[model samples]
Target chain A: MARSPFNADEAREAWRRYVSTGAVARRLLRRSTYHAWARCHDLGASPHLLKAEALSVSDTERLLAEQREFIAAATPFMAALSRAASSDRHAAMLGDGRGVVLDVVGDEASVRGPEAVPGPGCLLAEETAGANGIGSPLAEQGYVEFVGPEHFIGGFHPFTCQGVPIHDPQGRTVGVISTSVRRPAASQRLRDILVCAANGIEAELLRLRLERDVERVLASGSGSSLAKLRDDVVQTYAAARVRLEAAARRGPAASEYTLALVREAQRTIERFRHRAALWRDLASDELGMRQPFRLDQRVVEIVDLLATDAATRRVALVASMLEEARVVADARAASREIFGAIVSALENAGEGGSVEIAIRLARRERRAVVSVSASPAPGVAPAGPLAAQLAYEAAP
Target chain B: MTRERSGPGPSSGRDAERTALQRRVLLVDDDDDFRASVAEVLRDEGWEVTTAHDGEEALALARALDEFVLLVDYRMPGLNGGEVFEQMRGRSPSRLPAVLMTASKHVADLAAHHGFRHHVGKPFSLDDLLGTLELALRGGEPGE
Candidate 1:
């Protein structure tokens, strides 16, 4: 049998009892709402608090500007969700992870009155607003529905609200989507719509992030790098297939080993994906022979890209660098040599080994010096016309 | 619960309908031969398969349909598997479990990063493919 709908009258009576006697009627409230109310009481929040805090006019405008991408990603979804809810007494809102309202749509009257509509810049974090839809989700980093009397503060008792936190690609809550209805008995349909909209908004945010990375690649002037990255992705699979076929030819004994080989190839591609942008940087250097760029940034980027590979090999790659260390040379030659030197060093270090990359400015020599050193060090010493670049020095 | 191919035919209309609904899936890949072959296998296994050649095409189908799992290739031109999965997830109103198909070595990490519970490596056996898909349908993690 389906569970009965939420009872606001029973919740109201329970809330009064809890506020006066510190006792909870668990059956009358959702566990999430009960916990949120407990947290509010622990923080010494007043049940009689009349309104939520609002930001100053300038602060509100600044917040609106700061959350531009978040609002832009969520606007269409919020509008659609609001339309689907299709109630004149319902309002949808978008709030930052900090519980500050960024955007609100639908019936403004739902949030109207002494508590404020939580339009732009209203700070509804649980400490201030007391277990509200917007603020509770941010605090708990999950979905929260505070229906009418479920709100710790009496001011919110006239409204039923549900909030769902939106997460970034890394799974951190970046913002929240919420719905508010004027009456206590909220429709379940509106809550479902809000949750779906939140998920969709997060997906859009990830797409936008990828777009920005693409723009960065174009801005870095590495069109060829995009092609190179694409080629790398294609070649990775082809190479894995070759390895598999070779292992198969070696007989049945190689089956287990072939799986390992495929696993390693998979890691290579994963690392490649992780450092796809860095590949673009390398491609940029592959252009313009006399172009002067910060050798420090280049070295740092290489280190960042190789860090995962190094971890897999059980070798630590550490770097010490001087800021703004510029080197004017065949940028491609400098980067290639530096990358080769580091790879050689990582190899020489062996398992449980360490390779240090240092970038220093030799003011007297008027050059930015880079050195890759390992315990045993690489076999071949630095011998190149790119002396203006750096040296592959051994650490004694 | 495993469904025996021998059980209830079209005569059992409700069971057939329920099974069909439960077995629906979207297969996205740029490789025509691979996609077609996999779709055939899945169809043979009693799955209702929808195929897309690219991310954009997959997104269009996803928007048009609902309540199906996604089996996507990690690499494809214009949007790739990761982007397509995310975009579809954003556009849909329900949880859509997915299984990744990739030739890359770090298949596990790639699948996890892209929010896929399971992955089938390239040059995989028929059993491996079906098993992974079943695991995803069950909402189980890779090992489980």
Candidate 2:
């Protein structure tokens, strides 16, 4: 392969000058490249060489498991890029934002070379490997091409590399795609190829995320709509009943007859309102199941309300509380289930029994879980978990 | 020297009668029986009352009336109370004091959002309704 006219010695000279005089390497490098070089220096990385520190097999497996979705979405594009890299005797590497290479593909000779060869689980962060192709793009959050001696480490001077940062739907930098060639020259065409592949992967990630969201919505059904309709019906009936009673009181002569008729109509409307309210509550419960709520201050408020309720006055209620954390769940649904359990237990318990409820963060699961236990008076039967079943049956 | 009257006598009742006669209320509800009954009670109390069976009729009556307080039900058919009130506010040059009556516990929140002077929940006593109207007339807070 023909080498580019640009001399590698000039890049080395520029690096030496920048290191000794603390001057910017403007003519040979971009501003971002200089910033990356400074970051590497600040991180205490050696300018002459980098030690190979690959992640353990278990750590790599865990990372791959966590990023299964990303891998599934980017596989086809990565394969195509790998093919292109092989034709040029280069290597294509995909690394997470932390600069841990999750995948590497290319010709055996180029990928397995002794000097600065990256494999799966190899750490290429700027702090670890200095300002090279993967580390520079990861640091700058943009495309970067480093030729021969443009790399911060002298050991990497034999290879030319280009890299681009890949982003998720939210435009968060999630990973990097680095293409390295053993030849002295790195082409603009190579940089363009890596950028295109990154764009394709990002687009795929977005489509997959949207598909998952739509599926979730479809599974939850239209319970919220039904709940809203029931609310409207209940409101209308209540308004009508109020008006009928007022009319019955208007005239002294026909008051008895009018009152009797009003009473009949109100009885019918009241029955309908009661049924509609039940339906609304059920629908709301179902809707709550699909919704995610943070349990920070809301749990405290619910506990306070429960403590103030007339039903809890007869029993000793103890609540185990905790400082708030980022624990999210179907809080409304869960609360309804918990309330039902408590109500059942209290109703079944004999006079002078105590109930204990605990609301705390399950740190390992990263969620909030509520547990309730009731102790009945001597000779009284304990209430089972039948309340939750009843609640579920009642839900629309 | 002094005589106690059983009720407001002819001379003493004049001011009270005039105040009742001067007050006009536009009552809007969807149910025919409810509307008729409520309107009858308002008339018996000596106030001028106009009734509409639904939101559309309420808006039309509101537009034609020069001076009247609005007593609207929240969940009426067609435009519903809030929609009717919004349209009435938009079209009329003068702002009218409004009261929203509903069975929903969220009436207070609805009233706050829609700028109603008072909100009375349904199944309320006749005294409660009248008190709310009086409070609305005086531009006081929505008292229970």
Candidate 3:
């Protein structure tokens, strides 16, 4: 038979001294252990007998469900600890923050014996079970061990146990891992193992939390980038409409072409507004929307408007148009807002300045491209409407 | 439409003298296109327009001119519009009612902080700019 290091009389004297003068017993007992002793005393527990409150089956199931992820993460550690203590009459147990025993593994006959050993659903909080190993570590948020007479209850004098508090990544004490044996073993080595196991569980919790955060950031980043693009497009379209309206009021020489162009531009503006609204709506939807709009006709009309307006400004307009301009392909739909922005950019370059505007529309296999280039007249200060206009178009 | 002057009637001899005194405007913008177009409009409306390509030139003009309302761009290569306005306030003997124009979303905040009489955002209609200018000249009354 293995004997305890301290006898019942010594433990009783130590407890009495702690109760009388708290600081006098600090050498033999940690402050946390003394606090647990005080709590057990205040809870109306008897020091000479073992009595524990237990949670009902439904409550136990709810607690297990709430801690499902934690329990899963700590399973391998629990198994390894149980195997390490197999040679001794020891049982490994996991307890929640409230001290309810959630899991157990060991040689049943040896660990359980004739006494009703604490198992799943057993409430072992210090307030209910007195100053025992499992509940003390939970209360202290650190490692704890008690052998024989060190247990407050006389009935628990036959058993010895070691426990360590498990923490989450944020350093919050989440639960306790404990091992109980009928006879006391070398406690320091057992305490070291429990601490290492708790650390492994906390590391796993940190990794899981990091992965979840990364997933959320990636999901929100794509939507926000697209929203920014949509906002820029709407602003550019508004600027284009203002420029076109200003160009139309410039007088009678190019009235016919300007009138037709303005009407077409108005219709295109309306369509662009409608599409922008739709894009906003789709972005707000739970299921992501990836719809594209056809903009070939609008692109052609905008090009014509740019050409006519440039000619009226007397800035030398030059254009090369495609016969069947495939401005937007079925697979990749281009925005009318882009074309409007380009037209606005060209008109601003030609307005009130002797800047020559060049526009080109070319058709490739699956894409239609439009490019606008401008060259200001010499002796005109380089700081002109074109620079300001280009700056606005290029702004994110 | 012939808009009525807000302060005093142009027919009054005293009001005519005041109008002549405040007829000059200092237009400062880096962009030549905006300067030429806006100067043409202001001149057509019977105000003498003096132009400057940047802030330094505008400050030099302000020192030389007797009395003028200032129209300045907010963002410039050297000495931004707000800095120029501050420098002008320091140099000018009289309170200069001015209009600050910008293409930024912070125009209202900038205008309030700098105590500008009025502000207009870019891509603004010609009418809007004229209206804001008229209001600033009229001691900032609510425009009709």
Candidate 4:
């Protein structure tokens, strides 16, 4: 075969420079050695990760196995976390603050990865380091780039990587898990995706720590005051569990390989306990919060509000609107509610959906800002601006 | 030039029949709906087609069948597309030239190692899928 015009090193370097301009990519270099090494490869900087780092091949292999084991344990929780991010393009990712990736899994390549890999496994160097989901989430943690010019590495450009750090029960960063390409998204959910995934890992740890007994106590307390108190605790626990599980499982498909999405959702919802306590404190100390409005007391009211048919429809409507405006159109609306929703969605996607929405004002659109984020949902087809651009004159 | 197989390989005076196997396919994807749709579309393009729901099933069917090439999806529930390719790679030289279906377009370098004719992505139209299929079918032979 004829050698290409540019040497491999130079080619990777140029692309690295280009990708570094992206919001998440530039910040990646700021992480610790382990994270930096992971980030380097996530950006397709394999040459540097392999050569510059003093870590031996054996270390890389060990690290890869560590990541694999971590992800395997967190799989169910991560899968649930990505479901939300996958559904709404406007959704943000849940992050544990390390790195965010979308649509690809990031991990050290195995020696055998150079040959051929089998079923749903992505090559991380030479050997298969990721089962589809982990690679994308790892990439989501640093930079969510799917096969395109925006991604620095041509080899992985076709695949999207969405990742985020997973946290242990006490919220310490443990490892990362992500989804890889089989799923694809158009833009801007990369960082957001990692955040969501990170949150998912945390939620999983918490669920494993606390959720199992929650259901039992609530059920046993079927009737009476003690039973009612137990029921209340269970309800709060269940809600928190739901959110935690969702955040973990609903991540990008690339990230959810061996896990189920519902598990993650339940995990996220389980955090209601902490939030509920915070609400109680706010009622007493904060001025805006109503007096005598104990969060535990308002649980019924809050549940009522959430359970209303209209509320459910509104959630869907909001999610769909986010998809149309932010996920598909790349337009950022300015309303506080819209902003909050978009931010939350981005956070959700970062948990593991392979979508990146990078927002800045559009090139020529007057007074309009484009969200600079990408959503990396595997198999989620990207929408085009062909029609939206044509409709711009009519976009009041 | 690569040597032709004695019997199962290309035959003498069978050069005219290149169009025959060239127009047939063995497609593998876990999604039955997707497989059916692909088969129908390929049939429309003057090709014969078969489908498999999982990687194991696809590999099992491939060994039993003759003449047709293959199209496999990288992400299935079990025995994914890559595993199927590895199995196919173990087969006799007379049978080869499988194309892969993956969303991992970034792994272009790795996918190239499978010795297949093409690696296409999912969510593609029948036209795009068939185009690559036709291209692979035209070059229905393996490389060293």
Candidate 5:
């Protein structure tokens, strides 16, 4: 490894200037480091602090347990990184998003005395530990390094540190991986290693999550799978229906091929619809296993079933207004009324219109009110007969 | 496409402007066809809809845009809908108005647990989706 590019004397002078006068010396300090310094200063962190804060025993245990998967995914990479830097006298540290060091590996004495090595459970967040390897990268959610005097706290001044944030597949910075070495030992090689290790850990985390999701879906049994398939078939039918209806409204497409295609599409759609109806009957058997279910949940089922039906008519079906009351009614009857209301609304809903349904327990009347209303589509006339007819109400 | 005005009115113009502003929304779903189809319908309904295919894109958009109702799918490849909402809530000072869309049977409980005011089951109707968005925008919690 090569000596660090940063000048120790220069960094020391820059830190001195900023700490006393709050003025950053541009050419001497990195932009990220300057921002981190400003943040630490504003947070009232003591630059003279000698050691990082540690979490309580219980809190530390909880933090580790919560990060169990993350640790499992990252441990191998951490070990590899440690081995790669063993000759360079560097130690690797892992911290969660909050900058609590979760793990450390290799050559701890090379970076700091035993008391100052940010071992597991130490809080190295910028506000607490004052901008070192883990905290700086975690705070910026990016790559950063602190060489000697650039360290915000006096305790870390004898070390050079580099860190990179590790993100899950969702792009959330879940943790940071950092390395610390004796001053002048920092090199681009160490930064590259940190970056690669972080990427590896993230990829492993993604793989673990993918397996978990697959297991969850598989564990739910084949019924859920069939339900998913049925939903797709219904959505496809609805989309096809919408296109066919739109073409029909455009007047007879005089093209023979177009006419033939439309006919075949209609046949396919009819077959699919029939199959969907058969599936409904099959699903009813399972529904019987759990009778007297919540009406709202059953309504959700009907809405999902007929979702495409409403889309075929260019009508939006709004079921979010359904209340949370435990209305344990006959699922079949409730389904019929809700289905009838939605079907009626779809029939009368003009192009691009919406049908809003609300099922609320009429506390005073002790009857559940199933209200369905429709609003006109864009560029369409308002308050027409269909809109009026669409406002049908029923209490079942 | 050229759009025809039904009639001229200062009130109607104001209403249209207001609708466009108030109806800006972020639709996050991994399904390509479903996402595109819904976005088209919402646009036709006078909504300013922005679409993202996954949670990462959704979060980036949320960070960039100051305000918009989030219509996010419950089960995504990486971060689930609840996690996305949790991240947004953690990052911002105000509560972000959002609605959950899922095929799960436990949707109602999940939505309430995640602090979501409303939820629409998957393979949902356009009306249900729009209604849920409207409810979220209005700051009204369902089943209350």
Candidate 6:
């Protein structure tokens, strides 16, 4: 319903626009320095500024067409993480070394539809550590622990971001895993958790490469001549590309598709490394506590049904373990309550080991002491002032 | 895994004493006829119902009564939904579940500022309102 006195009507058109999708206002978040770095007036380019443009001859459209398959799968995961970081209990952000966010994930709906991948969303977009953690950590080439009111973006004074550089097997920094938050001291856990996750993924990638190289050597036969085997090694390296081609059919940008391809390839390769997945499972439980009610066992089973093969199953298993973890958590809380009651009972028994009307009045106030009302009163005068003082001392 | 309240448990028969609370619900709207229309439907659903004309009167009743749940429109003449929520928050009974009716996101934004647990967007029906009430007031489990 329209609340403004000027509008004066609670029509459906007005209602639907204001109420759906958990969306936030975009006009409030338009403070980015991406404009300074862009070489031209390309609406498609947000944060990325291509430095060596002289290298590509395909022009903007054709060159972007080639990279579409890569961006489709990757952009949204980064986007989802951004949205997740936004809800963090601490100050967090998604930025490059250049400056604060020019645009954000939630409002990306406005930039919908198929488009070429621009340089704006890539790691090269990074610069120095500002108030935002992403740029700062990237600049430092290591983990940074930034606290509240220490940020460069004044509007983001409420947030703290901690990003770790995502390196490929070659130890070259390829991307970043950052936690954007609004609380103090959250940067450490978020930073370490993400860094560990990214490392696990990279380890899986390296393992897969190793596996493929070994298989090729065996396939070509170890008895082969040195010259022939050297050729085989190069061929295997080329064939075992870790970057999978995403469907340009979804219309993602070049860089976006490339990131997706890398992630998907890593997931496929990661299945061979069962230990890494288990570590991720444990981290998921530790870091993702603020998520609202989790999927039930049946829902987890439903997820199991939706996925096919090893990579999909890896995603689904995380959901199943979360369900199992909840059962243990609930039981622990109940046992704690039971332990409290048992301790109270033992303490009552320890004091004289008997109960009567005289003893009842002598017990502490508020701790109702039971006695036989039917029995004749005890002959002894109950323990008084000094005993009361002793009982008071032990009351806690 | 079950524990019975037989010996040394909380005092017996506390549940039976709480049954006499007013089951009637007073839902206020500028649309008195529409309010009555819904009241008749609620009567069919077996609830005694009452209606108020505006936010100011609604807030007064919400403070004075213990049993009824208020469903108020967001954009009303004197004291809008946000004003009503803030004043109600002052009263001990403000935690009582409220169903806010709004045709815009601004209603949600305002309700969020005042800590309303839930809201029903317009183009909704009496059924939607009832479901939200069962959820917020009854603590009914939402879809798993």
Stretch of 10 with least lDDT, candidate 1 chain A: A243-252
**Candidate 5 lDDT, tens digit per residue, B1-144?**
111222232222445435554666788876565565566556655666778877778888787776788888776556778888888888989768888877555678888899887788654445556667766876777753
Measured with C-alpha atoms, the lDDT of residue B16 in candidate 3 is: 55
CA deviation > 4 Å runs, candidate 1: A1-5, A22-24, A111-116, A219-396, B1-144
Model 1 TM-score relative to the real fold: 0.43
Tens digits of per-residue lDDT for model 1, A259-295: 4543543453344344544454454444555666778
Clashing pairs in 5: A316-B126, A316-B127, A317-B127, A317-B128, A318-B127, A318-B128, A319-B128, A324-B143
* Candidate 2 per-residue lDDT over residues A41-156, each given as its tens digit: 78887775655467999998999899888776666556545654554677788888888888777777766766447787878898888887777898888888787777887777
Task: Provide the lDDT at A49 for model 3.
Answer: 54
Ranking by lDDT: 1, 5, 2, 3, 4, 6
Give the residue spans of candidate 6 off by over 4 A. Answer: A1-119, A122-131, A153-158, A182-189, A207-215, A218-396, B1-144
Worst 10 residues of 4 chain A by lDDT: A385-394
Model 2: TM-score, first chain? 0.51
Listed per model in order, the count of residue pairs whose N, CA or C atoms clash below 3 Å is 7, 1, 0, 171, 8, 32
Q: List ranges where model 3 is wrong by over 4 Å.
A: A1-9, A12-33, A110-113, A217-396, B1-144
DockQ of each: 0.05, 0.10, 0.03, 0.02, 0.02, 0.01
What is the docking quality class of candidate 5? incorrect
Native interface contacts retained, candidate 1: 0.02
Whose DockQ is higher: candidate 2's or candidate 5's?
2
Q: Candidate 5, residues A2-99: lDDT per residue as tens digits?
A: 22356777788887887787665756766677778878988888887888889998999999999998998788667656754666566789999989
By TM-score, who's the top model here? 1
Greater lDDT among 4 and 5 belongs to 5
- Model 5 chain A is weakest, by summed lDDT over 10 consecutive residues, at A387-396
Return the lDDT, model 5, position A270: 51
In candidate 3, which residue pairs get closer than 3 Å at backbone N, Cα or C atoms, i.e. clash?
Answer: none
The number of clashing residue pairs in model 2 is: 1
Candidates in order: C-alpha RMSD to true structure: 17.2, 26.8, 28.8, 22.4, 23.5, 27.2
lDDT of 3 by residue, A1-396 (tens): 222344546565665664455423434444555566667777766664565567898988998898899888677567645654566677788888889888877787644656646777887888778888778898777877776656666666677878888877567888889887778543444454555556545544543453354345347764433332333323333333333433323333444554443444344344444444444333332433233333434444444333323433445544444323423232222333334345444445544443322223333234334444554566444333452111111101
